[model samples]
Target: MATLEIKDLHVSVVSEDAPKEILKGVDLTIKAGETHAIMGPNGSGKSTLSYAIAGHPKYTITSGTVTLDGEDVLEMSVDERARAGLFLAMQYPVEVPGVSMSNFLRTAATAVRGEAPNLRHWVKEVKGAMADLDIDPAFAERSVNEGFSGGEKKRHEILQLGLLQPKIAILDETDSGLDVDALRVVSEGVNRYKASGEVGVMLITHYTRILKYIQPDFVHVFANGRIVESGGRELADVLESEGYVKYTGSKEAAALS
Candidate 1:
């Protein structure tokens, strides 16, 4: 089984021409078939952990080691990380104007798969995946995420997830803008991808609603800059009831509440 191990990760970003630390010695291990829910308040550096692991240029990994099945992840480029079985589903997926979703997805698949998939089989595969997600067939010809609704964008993220089939997936607030039905469809897509029991998932969210659909094996409470508490699925119920007041203090938690 694949393993993504993070040890004493410290990350920083340039703010006001100075380095500002975000992640303060985070340590976590995710193995295949496990879903880890990272729950935290806003500005708690939850997204930072995802971006840092995916090698975002803005966030610098000052100290720590991230290894994918024992391979150094920090040494790889953003695209290299994807090819190395590390996938990141962004909270806000970007728009690629003028590039058709069909073209974009196939190119990405080619890069990751090391060769272009057969056109005959690729079309059928893409159609099947899109149909499973309740996506319109016309979307294949549309510019990537351009003029798409919040739900549409989120669905496409999961579409990529299903197609690429990476070893480890970092999903950043996938439930942020999704409505009740959209949330269910998106969650189901994620569930389908991880059903193989060979994928490790890091699901980051502030609310526990998504957990209702895609249950997590582990729940982690992130406070300040690192994980403060860890537990099982029941911990989400605790968070839903008490909120993050216990971790972020009453003042900060109240503002978010």
Candidate 2:
């Protein structure tokens, strides 16, 4: 089974001409067939963890070891990570103004698969995945997220997840900006992808609503840039009722209480 491991990860990004540390000694392990939910307050480094793992140029890994199936991940390029079965669904999906979704998906698939998918079969594959996600067929020809609504962009992210079939998926705030129906559709899509039980999922979000659709094997609480608590599904229920006040210990969190 594939495994992604992070040990004592420390990450920083330049802010105001200074490198501000975000992820402080984050250690986690994700093996195939497990779903781990990372819940945290804003600015607690949830997205930073995703970005750092995906090798986003902005965040600097000060010290840590990230390995995929025991191979060093920190040494790989962004595209290399994807080919190595690491996938990240960004909190804010970016728009590719001139690239058609169909072409982009196929190109990405080719890159990851190390060969071009059969065109006839590839069309059927994308169509089926899009249909499962309730995405309109018209979207396949549109510029990637150019004029898509927030929910549409999110569905496209899941579309990529299904087509790429990565070993480990890091979804950062995928539930954000989704409506009730959109959330269900997106969650169902994720559930379908993980049904094979061969993919490890790291789902990051602040709310427990998404958990209602996609059940997690483990629930971890993020605070002050690291995991503070972890438990079974019931942990999500606790976070739902109590909020993050206990974990964050911030006036803002207390006010929400």
Candidate 3:
């Protein structure tokens, strides 16, 4: 099984005077066929952590390392990281007014696979993936993410995940705007991708709804730029029942008691 290891990672954003630190001494490991959930409130650096690992230019890795399958991820470019079997479905998918979804996904697949996907095979595969995600095949002809609803955008991300077939997928707040039906479709797409036994998932979100379908092996709580607590799937349930205020252990919460 492939492994993704984040060892003592410290991250910050680029700025003139001084870099703004986001991730602080974070460490975690995920392996093939496993699922991990990172739960946190807004501004807790959960998305920043994913962006840094995926080599996004906006997030600078000040220290530590991100290695995937024993390869140094920090040394690779964003595209190189994707080619090396790492994928990040953005929290807010960008709109490309000129590019059709079909073209964009095909180009990404070709790049990640290092060769052109067989025409007939790729078409069949894409069709199946689209159908599974409940995405209208007609939408593929439209410009990528142009005028797409929140649910549609999330499903499109999953479609890319299926077509690219990466070893690890980092989903950043994918459930944010999804309704019940949309959430089910997104979850099914993830499950289908997981069936291959080659994909490890790191689902980053603030809500617990998606956890019911993904069934994470490990659930971590991120706050103050660090993972303060972690446990098995039941941890997610605990958070669902009690909410973040209780588990976050804020000084305000302590003082109120």
Provide the global lDDT of candidate 2 against the true structure.
0.93
- Residue 106 lDDT in candidate 2: 92
**What residue pairs clash in candidate 1, if any at all?**
none
For residues 62-175, write the lDDT of model 3, one tens digit per residue. 899889989999999889999999989998999999999889988998898888899999889889889989899999899999999988999999999888889999999999
lDDT value, residue 198 of candidate 3: 76
Window of ten residues with lowest summed lDDT in model 3: 248-257
lDDT of 1 by residue, 20-110 (tens): 8889889999999999999999988999999999998999899999999999999999999999999999999999999999999999999
TM-score for predicted model 3 compared with the true structure: 0.94
Candidate 2 C-alpha lDDT tens digits along 127-214: 9999999999999899999989999999999999999999999999999999999999999999998995699999999999999999
lDDT of 3: 0.89
**Per-model TM against the reference:** 0.97, 0.96, 0.94
Q: State in Å the error of residue 112, model 1.
A: 0.9
The parts of candidate 3 lying over 4 Å away from their true place are 15-17, 247-257
Clashing residue pairs in all predictions, respectively, total 0, 0, 0
In model 2, residue pairs whose N, Cα or C atoms come closer than 3 Å (at least 3 residues apart or on different chains), thus clashing, are none
